[model samples]
Target: MNSLQDALYNWLTIKVVIDERPDDTAAVETEKTFYDMLKDDHSLTNIEVTKDDEMYYVHFDHEGERKKQRFPRELIEVMLNQINQQPERYRNYPI
Candidate 1:
């Protein structure tokens, strides 16, 4: 994979692992990885992802103000499907 694809796969892998095992010992490092990926890939800082019953919420700072966005669970599921199809792409992620 190219650098961008590799980075995205790694980031998504970290997100999935954190969601599945929030109490894992690698949580802190995974969070750092997530944040770094957001900054590098999307120019976003202070990023956080959270999920409720139906949506995934992304919170971040933009222009010195806090902003939030919601993504439907189905959209995330589509991304997860793509990730699952190429599991080897994500194998190098820490944790």
Candidate 2:
């Protein structure tokens, strides 16, 4: 997967773990994994993820310019659906 898709897959995986085990400290590590994956992209810096009532916002610097991308809930769901079709691509178990 490309960097963005990899980051989102990690985000979704950790989110499921967080929801299942809210008190698990290891979830923090999984969250960091998402950021670290994004940071590995040479073109991106200062990456951040935020959410409001309806959308997720990804902010970063690309090639020294600031940029942001918004992903609607439906878009995320669509990605999740696609991911579900090939669980082994992102995770060892079903998300």
Off by over 4 Å in 2: 12-23, 74-95
TM-score of 1: 0.47
Q: Write the per-residue lDDT of candidate 1 for residues 15-74, one digit (tens) a residue.
A: 665565455546448667756766766566676668799886778776687887766676
TM-score of each: 0.47, 0.52
Q: How close is candidate 2 to the true structure, as a TM-score?
A: 0.52
Which clashing pairs does model 1 show? Answer: none
Model 1 misplacement above 4 A? 1-14, 17-37, 40-42, 81-95
Query: How much lDDT does each candidate structure score?
Result: 0.61, 0.62
Best model per TM-score: 2
Determine which window of 10 residues in candidate 2 has minimal summed lDDT: 86-95
lDDT of 1 at 64: 81
Q: Over the stretch 34-74, how does candidate 2's per-residue lDDT look in tens digits?
A: 66666765456876767787887778887779888776755
